[model samples]
Target: MFFIICVVLLLCYFYMRPTVPRSPSCLVGKTAVVTGANSGIGYQTVLNLASRGCKIIMADVADMEKSKLDIIEFTNNPNIFAKHLDLSSLKSVRDFASEILKSEDKLDILINNAGIGTAKNNRTADGLHPVMQINYFGHFLLTHLLIGLLKKSPSGRILFTSSLVAFTNNLSLKTLNFDLEKPNYFDRHFVYGNSKLSMIMAADIFAKKLKGTGVTVNSVHPWLVKTPLFTKIHAIYKNVFFQMYIWLSQCVFGRDPWEGSQGLVHAAVSRKLKNATGKFFGDYAPWRKPLKAYNKQFCKEIWDASEIYVGLTPEERL
Candidate 1:
């Protein structure tokens, strides 16, 4: 009985936690790119930024015509544009970056918000694990390719959407790319957590390297929100008990997508955080003291390996 009561109290606390409020500052003429903008927190972030008069570029793998229409109609802003970007494919990422560089004069904000939670082991066309490629490597490369444009802005900001699991999971950087010869060794959840950890580490590394360059890099945990990612999990678990557990958790802890997007929005444009960089944010505030394992050495190792994995040329190194 006591355990049940404690669990109930915890659920209530999570449910009632306050979200970051939208910024009142105008972003007129500022340009931003948000990956995975078709749905979930990414979609909400686009709406919030568009409402504030920022010109938005929606980057996603699938067709975003519907989302673009909805955003234009809802925000009453026609500055939203769509671009094709398949994070799983290195070639696609390069092509998307090239087009953006040629077309847009400047990139004021970049939100690397696309991610996936896979239930099965799979490899992308780039010969890396699907989850790792989409969640970490692709964004790593895209950021590097666009650093020039980001630097052109007065105060550029880059935001990565990480997760709370990164703090608790035992991430093995050595096994980032699961060996195809040993397919049996792959664990879906572990790989997913490692990918998120990589994002945090990469953000820290970029922030350090970009010092005095007028560019800020940060990562954020959007909290638990009911999004399409759960549909994949539901398909993986068919047991009655597991299904019930998922339902209970969502009902108790999940916030609406807009509420979940607050931390990301705050990191992107909040005046309170304009000068903050190399930080992890949650609940619309800085998350201090991440695990000691996420050290400078580890971050450097991951950054170097990512450069090779993404085929970043020497000319592109920052």
Candidate 2:
């Protein structure tokens, strides 16, 4: 009887997991830019949007030729273009934005999807924690630089690929940087969670600042996804038991890249959420309530601190 009950529960869990719906709206003539487009959910998102007739810009440090080819062939949309964006490098972010500003007159969607989860402590060329730089600060700077172009559009949407970990961690606004001096400071999971939380907070602040500008900003926790990010975790833990656990968990609960990307696509193109801004989405729908840790004051502090970390000038502060 116990075994039968357990099996029944497992079946129900799998049956109830939300699936991404095909976007009903057409995106002909719309323009979208997705970071980390070379692989994972970003690559899947590019394919979906491209198929709907949206011109796409694939930005990542990885060689995007294969992804570009696949998207072009699968969607038969030749407008897919690639731009080199190394989210860990502030210089690279600026360079990519400059190029986009010069070439593209209109921007409809900006998906800040590139992220890293490193077990080791490392710093980027910008002198900040690598995971924090790639996950939050870099996208923060990129959005600031591209706001002018986004404003030119009739309606612009900004989507951040956040994680469930965001809700599980508390951010220390005083030290966005991990304390290398402390023995417990090198907790990579905590560091990564903090960065993700910051991204969600930043999205909320941006939504308020850009109110009535016809541009909206929101964040989504793409379900437990099977992507290269986990490969990094496996590389960190060489234990056979740990590796086996990862494999088992992925086999049981992980969503494919396409399934994981549904929430992001839904956030970007769904007519129902056209005016929804500063909201958290999960399973292609909004959370019933706001996160308890979401404080407007703390969000402002994060915004100011991030501006300084990224070297934004007073004039550039938005």
Candidate 3:
């Protein structure tokens, strides 16, 4: 009877402990830039970082005037500002980078969190698949353009928003280029998955390349959070499988945007993670990889392929 009572009390204590969420303190003088910050994961991440005293730069495709107001309202910090960025266009990325270079010389954090999932059969101004362009290549060029600024920070961190779909996507040399003649129409989830896989591979290669530069790169699975990106897909497609997925998301797997942003925040600010580089993380710790992420030949292939697809030669940073 005594032991049973003790176990019951322990269970009650464990259940009623009122777990405290992770809310780290002030960044003070540091600067953080989050892409797609108008809503969803990006917006929450911006606020979370701002709460810690980091000067926040919010970049997105939305109207800057309204977004600025919203961010100001959300953060109530004068340090928060919005920049117009359309990641679909490489030129837009270049122009945004140029503007940022003129304004801020150093960036402590670069969260490549802006992306599109499955969009219609369209191409960017750069003549690439809209999904691949916005999701991977755009972030690719943007990161390179800002590498100089990120490197200026004492312990710079670059975070990529990868997805579990990365494992589900089909990737091939042919698909990397939008080969219309290939007889395969886009599978929205698969394309998104491929882009995410590329992102993970890119993050790994990027961290390896920047080995001595004090810049750390990591990719994250933010889990299934409800965001506007899903609404863009066709209803018929959404009905087949995505609806059920979203339902499951609502029931069990989904997180609020704020909760989803925690892993990114932890990666950005935690001193404990200073040495944790060139890896994937989720749920706020070094991800338990089913297999080791490092494969010299595969990594090299991905780097080389990405470089080709983005029109970047090995010698060129942009």
Alpha carbon RMSD to native, model 3 = 5.9
lDDT of 1 by residue, 50-91 (tens): 999999999999899999999999989999999999999999
Candidate 3 TM-score, true structure as reference: 0.86
Estimate, for each residue in 224-313, the C-alpha lDDT of model 2 and write its tens digit: 789999888878876798789888667667888988988999999999889999898988777732363366677777788899899887
Can you list the residue pairs that collide in candidate 3?
A: none
Task: Give the whole-model CA lDDT for all candidates, comma-separated.
Answer: 0.86, 0.86, 0.77
Tell me the spans in candidate 1 whose CA falls farther than 4 Å from its real position. 2-11, 14-16, 119-121, 180-186
TM-score per prediction, in order, is 0.93, 0.93, 0.86
After best superposition, candidate 2 residue 280: deviation in angstroms?
0.4
The alpha-carbon deviation from the true structure for residue 154 of candidate 2, after best TM-score superposition, in angstroms, is: 0.5
> For candidate 3, lDDT tens digit of each residue in 47-133?
888877789889999866666667667767778888989988888988898999999979999999988866656566787888887
Q: List all candidate RMSDs to the true structure.
A: 2.2, 2.3, 5.9
